[model samples]
Target: MSVSAYKRVQRDLESPRSVERRIFNRITADLETWGAAYDRAESKADRLSALKGSLQLALVDNTRLWSLLRRDLSQPENALPPELRAAIISISYTVDRITADLMSGAGTVAALVGINRPFIDGLAGISGAEG
Candidate 1:
């Protein structure tokens, strides 16, 4: 392809929506892997270790996703309502608490899984709506 054409392709791949979708998909996949690892662990130590690592990965990815959403919401041209933006911010705070709790061994695998389900659903809805 021509240079311009190649640049266009790159731009399309890096578009905000495309980036968001990729992040969302990755988060979903990571959560699934974490769930499986948590479920298959055979001993208490193994289970705790698995859960800890899984929670760390999920928390990092979740943080990245929310940071992007916050950036978008902060843009002057963003069309999403103020309430929606506020809700997203609120959820980010909750994620922080959840991450801290999980890291401190005060949270459960089931709670992490429960928290991720709604995000997965929301991502799916966005994908469906865009498609």
Candidate 2:
């Protein structure tokens, strides 16, 4: 992925499917695990709570985002970083690529999900903020 193509790839993801579904599933699963882990962190309770709300928001966002991606992924080719920050960018990039491929309009499941170009861009922007 070249820098110029990054946006194109991101654009593609907006259309739907490809690798987005798999990636979204992974993200959802990871968030669930993370939430549970946070819950279990007795020693770090204070720290976790302090940041847990943000973490939970991110988790919810991941769930909503994953829902969109999965609908697309089921169609065809479909797809993280940071202590949490790196994780966000990494996930965004992977999903962007997968979504871009789906945007090419080659798969059948594309219509199932309603990921638009703005959504992908928003994800990128959100990820950048975290990064």
- Top model number, TM-score: 1
The TM-scores of all predictions, comma-separated, are 0.63, 0.30
| Local accuracy of candidate 2 as per-residue lDDT tens digits, 1-131 | 79889977776766444344445555555444444544444444443453345445544455467455445444434331214444444555555564333234222122212233334445445453554
lDDT of 1 by residue, 1-131 (tens): 99999978887779565556566767757766775665566665665677666656776777677777777787878887888887877877776786666555455555655655666656456443554
| Backbone Cα, N, C clashes tallied per candidate | 0, 20
lDDT value, residue 112 of candidate 1: 51
Stretches > 4 Å off in candidate 1: 1-15, 39-47, 51-55, 109-120, 123-131
Candidate 2 segments exceeding 4 Å error: 10-15, 22-26, 29-37, 43-54, 66-131
Give the lDDT of residue 32 in candidate 2: 49
Q: Looking at candidate 2, what is the lDDT of residue 6?
A: 100
As a TM-score, model 1 comes out at 0.63
